[model samples]
Target: MDLTRDQVEAAVRALRPDMFDFAYWVPEMAKEYRVTSVLYSVVSATAIAHDLSPGSELGVPPPGYPSSKVLFRAHDAHALSSLSIFYKRLYHRMTTGLMNCDIISMRTCQEVEGKFCDYIARQYQRKVLLTGPMLPDPEKSRPLEDQWSSWLAGFRQSSVVFCALGSQITLERDQFQELCLGMELTGLPFLLAVKPPKGAKTIQEALPEGFEERVKGRRVVWGEWVQQPLILAHPSVGCFVSHCGFGSMWESLMSDCQIVMLPFLGDQILNTKLMTEELEVSVEVPREETGWFSKESLSAAIISVMDKDSELGSLVKRNHAKLKEILVSPGLLTSYTDKFVEALQNLLNDTNLE
Candidate 1:
């Protein structure tokens, strides 16, 4: 086939941005992190389409993602995307498989990892690392570490609650009020990091009037930002009240902190459910019939998780310690990252690239 210069230039113009992004950032990030290779998790169609050509291979399609979407949603998901047919066709030609390492233990994830191993890995020949959770190095947060250690010295072990909903999550006034009141009612020393809601003039404006004054130095401390992993690792931190994001969940588990789950999304819901129901390392606060919960219920949940003598509390602490051991054990992260690098190296050495 003859290719015209105009055709070539048009293709170059279209593909230049992706090629530049990959070439520039991937190498920079790899060197900074001291990693041999990086794998990009699929967020958009570019990776799938760039690597796997349409009409190159034909089959029912790959099993894990697009195919699952097709299988589950049937006509609904497909109808919504003009590229649905493209994805259906693309995965059939996905000759190279992928690997996913777990940040939580297989036991903690409750066979969700097992099912992926059985289905996604076995069927697609993908690799998954389910070794253990990886934690951030606390040494990086030196100032925060110093402050935490000094502040926590006055408190006994497992006496303080570390509360942070993370950077992106913001609670409505009702929710925020309830949470604050509940923490106050617990009568335990606590640290809370929060962001003012959007359009709020001040972080002070995010809460109910007189709320801060009532709680000031009573039992709760509020900050705009606190180093999270360091705080969790502090001996004074007995419990973690979190939004149940995967990052927070893993951090809490790795730190052996009892989890108080208040999840708002699907992945979080699943993770929190696993922690509360399956792993017995966390508890969920009860809500009212109208979807708004009382401060009283929240206080009760906190008390249960914090109380060493209570049955459920005892169970949660025990399991949390066990999970924390698994999370912090050495060689899990090294082995997984090594395997990932080796896999990418193998891919690079392959003669299949165009």
Candidate 2:
């Protein structure tokens, strides 16, 4: 609930101008609290109201204390994926608007890299500072294999295709049905972690009618939630069809699977563009006039990417290996963080830094 109008006005008036320099640890936290729009407006307003010069560098940090490193080392995909998305959105906003902060974006999306580089070059006239698409070390991730094996049961070999979209976006019904059909066309065992649309009860209702039985045991498994990182790491997962959210993209890449990009909204389209254009890690699926994906298009995209022997698949695998190496390296992220903080401190000391 909102405070009284007088209270809000007073609070606004009392807003400390120095808070403009304060970093937001996680942009997604506002979304969790259902106050994302409000927070966005407040930050924009405060910047405008105070005539605060946008800082030369925005020093955005991923959520939590450095101890998250030790705490989450052997954790599931969910934790790592969530933090990655948080950092991405935070950096995007910092780089985009009047706030004018240099963001430490993870090097996962080509779009983020492109926009950040352009912002640094054309806008800030400087070099961009990037962290990693920080990966859990392979040695650390290896121990989780047996645990995932027990969770996946019979689908433990190289048969399953893991499908996941990130937390922010949802699919319209038509899109969902088309995706179902695409899975059917794959002729591979699939596990899809799909959140239902705003009001739908079962995916069966939202998916193409009779679509469930069409694939039955051989081709499909659908749930509102699945252990995605586990699914990605599973030996059975042959491919990934994803929304190109940085989290899913990183997980899938680290899994060494071929990817098909179906970007829906936000920076995702940009991320997908990067995945296709710069990194060559995946193929882009076409969206129609209204930016919706259709069954025919989805089917074609899926078939094109899933072929193990295809040139496109080989290119994707090669690129993923390169990117994955950057992500899983030890102390790489810490080094980035140290450099970022040093940059920020230097900027704070220089009046003409920006």
Candidate 3:
């Protein structure tokens, strides 16, 4: 259901007491049922920790903890302030969970976020466990939908550009039109799956005037959910323009497509940086000081990675290929799973001794 901010806050408050009760009940149930351990997701862990131990200190970072500037680079004071607030909230939540949990687990690997994981372990004085990327096994998933399969089959290999800005982002009308127009400017077939812009009832309603006629037969701007992983695996899909969500980040890495990013949220921005700056496997569409991106800039970013002769395109493709090989190597994922299970068993033994 669509909810206003006040409504959301009210709903959260209504649920808070029950949530706390559940958190407290968990420990009791564990004792009564002889449940040896409680493996909590980060958010749940935070709540349990708050209710069970309220005054635990979030200690100072260990030496060599990256400075704020290293973690994020804000262009201006306003941006910096926003980043600071967002990170402070995130850090507090994560640290609380890390402190309370018997085993700290993450859906990440040393190949990607090792340094950050190490920092958390040292700062929180806990053993942080990694679960690798935890990507879905594509083999077990259903095939791509017929309509998408047939449509994609019509194009030559690596010829079409595909863009999905995650399920949560809804651009303003003007910005939405700019995005559509930008894709059209790329002069390549594209599939743009996004929510209808703010104040618009449908994807058709939010289109720039005459936009459909101009881009017909070569573009699709759908407003509903589609099979993302299957679509990404299709042969004709060459480049991926994504919002850099965590799941999408791993998906893009695993695929053979060229990567371009446009991130909106705090974690998303960090994911974009990891791909574009640190990993050197993607190019980001730069935003202005106002956090606005123009059609030209958007088109330019896509083209930089899609063009055959573009040095940036070639560079990322090479780097992505190398990283993908490592991520998909035999037993890499299974090794993480195996280790995670072993860690849990060890924790159980330790608990029994105590």
Top-TM-score structure, candidate number: 3
- lDDT preference between candidates 1 and 2, better one: 1
lDDT of 2 at 275: 67
TM-score against truth, every candidate: 0.66, 0.63, 0.82
Clashing pairs in 1: none
Local lDDT at 4 for model 1: 46
lDDT of 3 by residue, 157-179 (tens): 99999999998788999999999
- Which parts of model 3 have CA positions greater than 4 angstroms off? 1-63, 66-70, 75-94
lDDT of 2: 0.53
Candidate 2 has its poorest 10 consecutive residues by lDDT at 42-51
| Model 2 spans > 4 angstroms off | 1-115, 125-128, 134-153, 219-223, 288-290, 342-354
Question: Looking at model 1, which ten-residue stretch has the lowest summed lDDT?
Answer: 101-110
TM-score-best of 1 and 3? 3
Query: What are the per-residue Cα lDDT tens digits for candidate 1 across 1-354?
Result: 123435534544454422111222233333333333223332212123222322322222342432222121121221124234545653432332232221111212212233433343343343433432334556664655566678777888888888888776766766777777788888888887777665675566666668777766535545377878888877888889887766787677778678897655434544555567756788977656555567898889889988878898988888887766765567655565566546555644552352
Candidate 1 residue-pair clash tally: 0
Of models 2 and 3, which has the larger TM-score?
3
For every candidate, C-alpha RMSD to the true structure in Å: 9.8, 11.9, 7.0
* lDDT ranking from best candidate downward: 3, 1, 2
